[model samples]
Target: MSEPNVLRVEGLRVHYQTPAGPVKAVDGVSFAVRPGERFGLVGESGSGKSTIALSLLRMIKPPGRVEDGSVTLDGVELLELTDEEMRRVRLARISLVAQGAMNSLNPVKRIREQIALGLREHGAAREGRAFDTFLTELLERVGLRRGVGDMFPHELSGGMKQRVCIAMAISLEPQVIVADEPTSALDVVVQWQVIDTLRRVQSELGAAVIQIGHDMGLMAHSVERIGVMYAGKLVESAAVRDLFRAPLHPYTQLLIASLPSLDGKERLQGIAGSPPSLLNPPAGCPFHPRCPFVMDVCRTTMPPPREHRPGHFAACHLYETS
Candidate 1:
């Protein structure tokens, strides 16, 4: 039998109420992340990738609510947990390394103090020398010097600050870590370094990782499986190699084709048109507007997910007839 999934999300729908209408940020999306697995969610900005991350922790703010779906983590239904119960689960079981996390740190607090706060709140460490030693170890695990913890957020480079965030995320040895655009805003060289650090630390702790980002190239290398999201829905999902080798969905194909080749011989192609406005999304398939192979059925009726291969699944009319 297959190992139980560390995290499973089913039919999740997060909508924001506005003067215009309900913005379907995450409309009927579902996927699973196995223990110690690296799952990547890739798409353009406003594709609802980040919204899924926030929903996993039940952190959706006012005007936005999880209208439907179940979020099960380690057999426990996260959507059923109370606010106080979820708070205990946050760092103790699942942690988040948010996008632009470097800037999210308090500028006034020392790095050590910030990290120690979580540990203390969760009762993971005692005060005094025990906490100091634990904090130092956490910093070193993320490839930072132990002494760097004494410095304020402004004192460190962007990359170093990101590392500190990663360290904090792993401090409690959580079963899963949601890293939403952890390497965003950093240079290419620093991006790779941060990715490497994340991979190493996650491996050491045996934690499943959900790496969310717009860069398919980075996701291709960083994750074992990939899920392509378009206009608040998951269009395709498959193993990294399988998805790259034979993408079944038109949107997935376009995304992969848009990436520049290493040899500089193949011309990169860009996807045509912009994503539909979520408030007034296209009637049927959300991607039908920009899809090159869109048919009449696609414009009027939603396509159901079809299994093209053993593990590959795609939601498109083209595969419906297969």
Candidate 2:
């Protein structure tokens, strides 16, 4: 029997309107998340990683809109839902630990109060000590002490603030957690701690997690499957071991090659050339400009996503072997 998927995104396109023109932040991206699966989305800055995350939760603010696509959670299409309806679904069903979430917390309110805000918004209890008890437990579960909940955001360290943010996101027992760069601001030790905590919470709660990170090394250990993104498109996706052992896309290979070795002396060589601006991306394959093995066809026509190996999919002219 196949595992049940908690979310499915199909042909998702997101664009941002700037003074100059429309920026195609996320163009025609598609993927899925199975229950209890830790799916990693890896890419450098400007690859639309965070844009995809925001679009998943319908949190794309003004100047940005999901121009096309269907984001289905369970059996429901979220893109069609109204703002009011989306609010109901945001935390109760599909929660998000967004980038800079520590800054999202209210400095004026106590941690307990901020968490309770989500509970109340999602129709969880707002009154009595019941909510307080739940908040305490969630804080402790995320590696914080119960008393930490009484402090304001300013009182906590950066890592502590992040823990509070995670606690709030999971307090509602959401079915899927979309964590965008969850460990971006932490030290090495704190990063591992947060990843471990996320893994532990995921196991105990049985919720699927979508982890978006640019660091291949961090993702190598945290996720079961990896999706590589380039210039707003999904370049390749495969199971964790397969992706590490034999990445099909040239971009994926280069990304993996850039990871720092345990020996700590070899100079890590990252990919050259900056990512293309979404406002006016390359004509053919979005990655064609940067792909070392780029062929003539890659410069004229976009490649459709195809199964390069069993369960491994890639979008590149190189894999269009008829």
Candidate 3:
């Protein structure tokens, strides 16, 4: 965590060309991930967390494009690379564990065949029994049985399917892993198992991880740092302990307050009003309409992100006054 940043993102903006004008999915968001560190992106649905993931890997398809930004991996500007160059970079250097395991895997292909895709593409594939031995080790690394190499997607449980995705993600030992909701839709036990599996493999490979999810509780103990986003903008970013202990932005505070308390003492509260429409957000801060501490400056001008405390950054008028 003390190492220099392995991946740096700055001034990122991703927009979708909808019929009702362009929807700003990501608006000038910036953050960085250090080697072998676990970073979390937590926000409500439609807050552009997933969009930032897509933009990082240069996967935003037609209709949605990374308008302006700088994504550099080890000092190489990702935005400047050619399509094929970026293609080579993926899996070999950067891999993704998609949110939906079933959707990410091919139902028609067996697990062994599917796992071979990255190895083969990256020129590390072995044939016959040698390949079987390699595949078995890969599956075992993610807490899967050796027999799982012959099973299809439907045969595995939700957690197992996700573990399979993790196995595939680490086959080539990439430098970074982007896990977009890797534990969603699973029971508590299964979620814990999958998260453990992810952490184990990440440790063995020594890869930096960017975990994107809506579960703040899950993120609290699983990561070192957290970035909070709202309505296409990063409202706050800080160390996980500091973020939970002293939330800087209003949205961050409300989000933490909304989580159910384990002691059953504090009432679980929901934030008033819904997230703004990205197609036509408010003039100043998009979160101003829902914020309780709104001010004249917040209503009229978009607050630039500033480091309020050491390594803690927030975009809000309250800090400016303090």
**TM-score comparison, 1 vs 2, better candidate:** 1
lDDT of 2 by residue, 205-225 (tens): 889999999998899899999
TM-scores of all candidate predictions against the true structure: 0.97, 0.95, 0.96
Report clash pairs, candidate 3.
Answer: none
lDDT of 1 by residue, 122-241 (tens): 777657888778877888899999889899999999999999999989989999999999999999999998999999999999999999999988998899999999989999999999
Worst 10 residues of 1 by lDDT: 118-127
Task: Assess candidate 3 and give its TM-score to the true structure.
Answer: 0.96
lDDT of 1 at 51: 94
Poorest 10 consecutive residues by lDDT, candidate 3: 259-268
Ranking by TM-score: 1, 3, 2
Candidate 3 local lDDT, residue 138: 91
Using TM-score, give the best candidate's number: 1
- The models' CA-based lDDT, in order, is 0.92, 0.89, 0.90
Return the lDDT, model 2, position 6. 83
The better candidate by lDDT, 1 or 2, is 1
**Superposed Cα deviation of residue 257, candidate 3 (Å):** 0.9
Question: Model 1, clash count?
Answer: 0
**Residue 162's lDDT in candidate 1:** 95
Name the lDDT value of residue 214 in candidate 1.
94
